[model samples]
Target chain A: MAQKVVEEAVVAVTEPAVLIHRIALLFSPGRHWLLLILASLPAFSLFATVLPEDRADVMYHRYDGGGVEVDGPSILVRKSVMDTVSLSANYYVDSISSASVDVVSTASPYTEERTETSLSMDYLHNKTLMSLALTKSDESDYLSETGSFSISHDMFGDLTTVSLGYSVGNDDISRNGDADFGDQVKRQNYRLSLSQILTKNTILGVGWETITDEGFLNNPYRSYRYLDPLAGNGYSYLPEVYPRTRTSNALALRLKYYLPYRAALSSEYRYFNDTWGVDANNFELAYTHPFKEKWIFDIRYRYYTQDGADFYSDLFTRRAPQTYLARDKELSSFQSHTLGLAMSYEIKPGFLQFVDRGTLNLAYDYIHFDYDDFRDLTRGGVVGEEPFYSFSANVIKAYVSIWY
Target chain B: MLTNHRLLPLVLLLALTGCAIEPWVQPYERARLADPIMSFERDPVANGFRHHVYQTREAARGAEGGGGGGCGCN
Candidate 1:
C-alpha cells in the first residue's frame, strides 16, 4: 500500500512537469511568454465577453510658442468591419495669428483665423483594406483640400502584401476677393508597392508614386517684393504665372524590425523628382518599446529637404527675364525636421469592466521649418534676410479605445 | 465671388469624405497592426506633413504623383 501511494504521487508530479515543459517550448522567454499568455487568454476564453466596438479618440492641438498661435480639436470613432465595415472621421477648427497671409489686412499680425475638418473611411475585409479618404481646410487667408483612395492587401499567409492606389484633387488659394491667378491645380496620382517578409520578425517593402498636374498653377496669395508697376510702393510683385503642366515621380522603401514582446524599430526613406527641375529627399526613424503588463512608448524623428523648382525666384535676382519664369516660392529651397513622442497605457475600464479591451493613449509631435539660402545672385547679402524665418508647432492627441 | 466660392465645395467634399473611409486598422488593432511609428500608420501622417512642408517651401504642386482624386486644379 505504501508503494502504491508513492507511485501515484510520482504520476501527479510528472504530469504537471510535462505540461510546463510544453508551454516553455512554445513561449520563448523575454517577451513571447507574456504575449502567449495575453494572446491565449482570449483564445481560452473563446471571447466569452466581446469588447464594445464603441470608442472615442480625440486630438487637441495648439501651436506656436509666441505671437503666432493655432488651436484645433479632432475626434475618431471605430466600428467593427465584421459587422458593418469600420468607419472613422475627424474634424478640426483652428484660430490663427501670424505675420503671414492675413486676409483682414488689419496690420494686427493676427487677423487670419480659419476652420478645417478632414474625414477618412475604410471598407474593411478580413484580409484586405480598401479606403477612400478626404481632407479640407478653410481659413481666413487660404483654402486647401484633397481627396484620395488607398488599398492594402495581405498575402503570403499574411506575410507578404501588395498595395495599389490613386488620388486626384486641387488646392485653391484666395483672400479678400481674388483667387491667386493660375493658383488652381488639377492633379492625379498612382501608386504601386510590394512588401516582403524578410524574416518572422522583419518586413521590408518598396513603393513607386507618380503624380500629374495641369492648369492654373500660381500662388496669387504670395509674391516676391518688387517695385510696384502701377505705384511706387517700396515693394510690389509682378503678376504670378501658372505652369500649364507638371509631373512628379517618387521612390520609397520601408523596413520594420520586431523585437521581443511587441517592441519594434521602423524606418523609411523616399526620393522625389519632378519635370519642373525640383528634387526632394525624406528620411524617418522610430522605435517602439513596451513595458511590463500593458504600456507602450514610441519615439520618432524625421528629416526632409527639397530643392526649388527651376522657375522659382525671390525678392531680387540678377538673372535676366529668361531665367525668371515667374513663381515666387518656387525659387527658394526648403527643409524641415520633426520630433515626436507618444505612449499608451491600459487600465481597468469602469463602465465595462466585464469586457477586456481598454487602453488610453497620449501623443505629441513638434516640427521646425526653414527655407534654405539659394538666394539672389547680385545682392550677395543673405544678410538682410531672416533665412526664411523659423516656424514651430506642437500637436497633442489623446485616445481611448477597446478591442474584441 | 462665385468663382471664389468654388473652393467651398472642394472643402466640403473633403470633410464629407472623412466619413466614407477609415485607416485600414481600427483603433484597437493599432497596437497589433498599426503602431504609430510603423510605415502603415506613418504614411498618412507623413503625407499630410509633407504637404504642409511643400506648401510652405517649394511650389505646391509637382510634376508626377500628387492629387488623390480626379478633379484638376483651377
Candidate 2:
C-alpha cells in the first residue's frame, strides 16, 4: 500500500508539467493571428490598453536548517509587447551546502549549485487569456527541460472564470561520484480550475490536478540500511529501489474575503492521494492589510500532514531487502507547520523620472517538521533508542520590483 | 481511491453552492472587486517565488498552474 502511495506522490508532483504543454499547444500561429485580429476590433478596444508596461524584479532567498543551508538570487523582467501580449524572462540560482544527518551518517557533505532559466508569454483577447512558458534547469549531475501552457476564460459579466492547463517535462539524472550511473524521467500534468465571485466582498476557487510519471524516480545517491543478524547487530546500506511509473491526483479549494477595514483574508485547503498508501492534507490561512497608503503587511500560516509510503521503513529487519524499498524521510509519515510574515512598501509615483511605481518587499518564514515513524540515523544502531526525526528551518526573502 | 470517492460529493456540493449563490454586480459597482488587493495574485514575481519554495519543500504540488521544472532537491 505504501509503495502505491509513493508512486502516486511522485506522479502527483509531476502533474504541473503536463498542463503546461497543453496550454502551449493551444496557441498555434493561426490562433495567434486570430487573437491579434480580435484585439484590434473596435468592439474589444474598450477592454484593451494601448500603452505597454515594463517591470523588473530582483529577489534573494536564504534557507538554514537541519545542517543544510541554501542561499540564492533570482531576477525577472517583464515587458508588454502589445496591448494584449506580454513576455517575461527569469533567471534563478541556488547555492547549497549540506551536512545533514543522512549525509553525515552515510556520505560526506558537499557543496553544489543549480541554475534555472525560464521564458513565458501571455496573451489576453477580450475575455480570454492564454499563456505559454518554457524552463530549463541545470546542475552538475542533473538537467531538466519543461514546457507548459494554460488558458482561462471569463463568463457572466466576468463574475466567473474557468481555466485549463497542461505541462510536460523530461529530466536527465546522474550522480557526480558514480560516473556509470545515469537515468531519465518523464512527467506530465493536467489541471482544471474554476473561480467565482460569491459577493462584493468574497471570491472562491476550486482546482483539480492529475500527474503521471515514468522512469527513474529514486535518488541515485541515497541508500537505506538494514540490520544483519550475522554481523552482530550492525547494519548494512543498500541502494533504494522504486517503481518506474506512478499516477496521482490532487484537489484544492481557496477563498478570499475583503474586510470593511481594507484588510483581506485568504484561506486554502488541499487534499491529495496516490496509488501508494499515502494520503495528505494541507491547510493555509493568510491576512493582508495596507497601512499609511504606502505599506502592506501580510501574515500567513500553513499546516500539512501526510501518511507514509508502504515500503518506507527506518530499518529493515530481514537479511535480504524487499524488491522495492526506500527510507527517504520525505516518504515517511510526517506533519509540518509554517508561519510567515511579509511587508512591502510602495514608492510614490514621480519619485523617479522613468519609474512609474516601485516596491520593496521583505518576507520571512519558519517551518517545523516532525516525523512520526522515521528516526534519526546519526545515533548508533539501537532499535528503540533512536530518536524520531525532527527539524526546523527558517527562510528569508527580500526583493524589489519596479515598473516603468 | 475510496477517500476520493467520499470527497467528490463534497467537492461537487461546494462547487454548485458557489455557482448558485453568486450575486450579480454591475460594472460600476465593482470598485471593491477591482481593487489591486482583491486580485488573486497581486504580485506575480513574488507569488512565483513563494510557489517555488513551497513546491520544493512539501510533498504536494500543482494547485497553481505549471512552468516549474524538476530538481534533485526532492
Candidate 3:
C-alpha cells in the first residue's frame, strides 16, 4: 500500500473543509463575507436567473375648453414578476367634443367616446407594502366598475410610512338618446397615509380621504333654471335635482425639500368637505431640476377654491319647485388656476439594447376658471348685468418610456 | 369656517409634535431620502394623468387618493 493511499487523500480533503465550516456558520455579519466569496468560485453557478423589469408607456392628451374638445391616448404596462412582485396595465381614451356653454345653450353638438381599463398588483414584504386594483369604464351611455385595496407599513426604521385604503364603485347610466333612461350609481372610498423622514433633506406627508355617494347623482344631459315670471326676463329649463346621499372629506399636506443644487422643492395642501354644501381649498407648488446627468426639469403651481351647493343657483329667483336643485357649474362658486411645465430626457443604454432605461416626456398645462357664483345661462338674465362665467384651458402631454 | 375647525386640532398637534423630535437617521443617511424626488409618486403614469384631469375639472376631489366611478364628464 502506498502508505494507504496517502491516508485516503487526506480524508478526502478534510471532508470538504468540514462542510465549508458548517456553511460558514450559517451566514450573518454581512452575510459571512458574501458566503466566503461565493464558496470560492470555480465554475461558479449557484443558480440565478431573475429577469423581470419591463415597462412601456405611451400617452398623449389634449383638452381645450369653451366649446370643448378632448383628445386622448394612453397606454401603460409594467412588470416585475417577483423579487417582491409588481404588475400593471392600463389603457385609456377619451375623444370627446362638445360645444359647451351648456353644450351651446342646452343640447346638441356632440361626439363621444370613452374607454378605460386598468389592472394592478404590487407586493413587497419586510416592512410591508401591498396593492390591488381593477377598473373598467366605457361610454355610449356610461358604465363603470372599480375595486381597490392598499396597505403599507414601515415605521421607525424606514423613518415612518403608513397607509391604508379601500375603494369600490359601480355605475351605469344611460340616456345617450334616451334608451329607456336607465340609472344607477354607488361609490365609496377611504384612505389614509402618512410619511416622515424629515431631515436628510426633508420629506413629510399626510393625507386622509373619505367619500360615499349613492344612487342617481344627476346629469341626464343637465339643465336647470326656473323663474319663468312670464318668460321675458328669461329662465325656464328644468331637469336637475340631486341628493340621494353624498358625503365627502379630504385633507392633505405634503412637503419635500432637497437642494444643494441637485434641486427639488415641493408642497401641497388641501382641505375639502362636502355634505352637499361644498368647501374646498387646494394649493400646490413645485420645482425640480436636474441636468447633465440626463436632463429633467419641472415647474408647477396650482390653486383652487370652492364653496357652493346648498341647492346651487345662479338664477331662480323663485317660481316654486326647490327641494334640491342645481344649475351645475360644478355646483357654483369657484376659482381655479393651474400652470405647469415639464420636461424629461434620459436615454442611453447602448441604444435600447433590451433597454435598461429610456424616457422622453413633455407636459404643459394652463388653466383658469373663475366664477364667483355661476351665471351666464347663455347670458339671458341680465337684470343688473349677469354674465359671470369664465373659462380657459389647454393641456398637452406626450410620453414615452421604456425599461427592461 | 369655525376657525378652520379649530385650527385642525392644532395642526394635528403640531404635526405629531414634529414627529416626536426627528433626529435619528442612519441607514447610510438615506441617500437624499432615497431620491426619486423623494417620491410621493414621482410619475405614476404622470400622476394618473393628473388625477384624471383633476377629476374631470374639479368640484373638489379627494386631494390625491384613488377611487374612480361616477362621471357624466365630471
Candidate 4:
C-alpha cells in the first residue's frame, strides 16, 4: 500500500509539470497566462476530497538597509476545486535601488527589478496529499526556473504526519552590459520532515534538507579587494571567484505549545553546514496572542550566526591568492538578530455576500547584522585594519486576505 | 535502493505500531490545536517574503519547508 501510494504521488506530480509546460509553450512572452489559468479554474472543482480553504491575498512589502531600498507588491490566489484538488498562483515583484557599501566602492549604484510567478497544485488521496509547484523568476541579469514535488501522509489516527519533497532548479546568469558574458547554474534539493502531536496542547516538528548546486555561483559584477600599496586606496579590486559546485545540509526542529490563557508559543532551531565550510545556527522564538475574537498579535525574535566559507576573505595579500576567492559579505562570518511584530484584524463575517471572511494584517521587523571578518571600507582608516562591518535594516509588510 | 534500505525500518516501525496506536488527544480536546494561533505558518505570503530576504542575506538556506528557485544573487 505504501509503495502504491508513492507511485500514485509520482504520477500526480508529472501531470502538473506537463500541463505547465504546455501552458508555457502556448503563451506569448508578454501575455498573461496567469489570468487564463484563473479563468479556467472553476471547471476543475468536481472532486469530493477535502481541500484547503479558498483565499486571495494582496501584499505590499518594503525593506531598507545599508543604502539599499527594496519594495514591491505580491499577490496570491488559492482556490479549491470540488474537495480533492487545490490550486494556487502567485505573482511577486521586487524593485531594488542600491548604493550599498560594496557597490559604492567598486561599482556604480544601480536600480533593478525582479519579477516572479509561481503555480502550484495539491491533490488529495485519502490521507495522502501530493503537491507540485512550478516557479519562474526573471530579472535583468538572471533567470531561474524551478519545479518541486512533495508527498505528505497522515497516520496514527492523524496524530503524526510525514512529508518527503524534492526540487530541481535551473538558472541562467548574464552580465548587464556584457552580452557575451553568460553562465548557468543547476540546483537540486531533497527534503524530509515529520510532525507529531505530543499532547492536546503541544506539537513538534523536525525537518532535514540537502541541496546540491553546480556551475557558476558568483556575482559577475562583484569584486574582491587585495592589498596594492601603490594603488590609490592601498588596495585594488579584482573580480571574485567561487567554487563551481557546492552541497549543503540543514536540519531544523520546531515546537509549538498552547498556553492556558488562549495564547500560543513557538520556538525553532536550525543547524546548517555546507561543502564550502560554512556553518550556521539559527534560533527563533515567537508568541501569538488573540484578543477577544477579532484581533491577533504576534511577536518574534530570531538570531542567526554563521562562519565564513573556507575560500572567503575580507582582504587577500595578493591577486588570485587562493584557488577559489570570495569576499562576499554573505560568505563571511556574521551574526544577525531580528525582532518582529505583527497584528491581524479579522473583518466581520459576511462583509460581502460572496466572501465568507476577510483579514487585514501588518508586520514589521528590525534586523541588526554584524560581520566579524568583513570590514567597512567606507570607514577608511586602513584597508584590512578598518572596523568590522555592521548595519541595521527595517522591513515592513502589509496585506489583506479575503476568503471566498 | 539506498533510500529503500533507509526507509525499511521506518516502514516496519509504522506497520508494527499502526494497529496498537490510539490517539491520546480526543477529537473534542483538539479545539485548541485547531486554532489559527497554533498554525506553524500563520501567513504564507508574509512568511514567503521573509524567507526570501533571509536566503539572500545569509549563507544558510532551506529546511523551513518552503522551496523556490534562487535569483543567483547570493
Which numbered prediction scores highest in lDDT against the true structure?
Answer: 4
Tens-digit lDDT track of model 3 for A1-404: 33443333233222222222233333345544443444354311111111123577888888887778888988888776645677888888889998888767677889988988888777766557677888888898888887888777765545777878877888888987677889888888888888777776788888888888888887888877776767775567778888888888889898888888677888899898889988888889989888887888989999988888888886677654678888878778888899999998988669658776777888998989898877766676565257788998888888887766
Q: What's the lDDT for residue A112 in model 1? A: 55
Candidate 4 chain B, run of 10 with poorest lDDT: B65-74
What is the lDDT for A100 in model 3?
83
Residue-by-residue lDDT tens digits, candidate 4, A100-137: 98998889999999998999999988768889999889
Query: Where does model 4 exceed 4 Å of error?
Result: A1-50, A349-351, B1-20, B66-73
Q: After superposition, how far is residue B23 of candidate 3 from its true place, in Å?
A: 12
TM-score for model 4? 0.86
Instruction: Give the number of colliding residue pairs in candidate 2.
Output: 27
| Per-model lDDT | 0.54, 0.74, 0.72, 0.82
Per-candidate count of clashing residue pairs (backbone under 3 Å) = 33, 27, 0, 3
Sort the predicted structures by lDDT, highest score first: 4, 2, 3, 1
Q: Give the TM-score of chain A in candidate 2.
A: 0.86
Candidate 2: global Cα-lDDT? 0.74
Interface root mean square deviation per prediction? 11.7, 10.0, 16.2, 11.9
Top candidate, metric DockQ: 4
Measured against the true chain A, the candidates' chain A TM-scores are 0.71, 0.86, 0.29, 0.87
lDDT winner, 2 or 3: 2
**Candidate 3 to truth, TM:** 0.31
Error of 4 at B68 (Å): 5.4
**Off by more than 4 A, model 2:** A1-54, A349-352, B1-23, B65-73
Clashing pairs in 3: none
Interface root-mean-square deviation of model 4 in angstroms is: 11.9
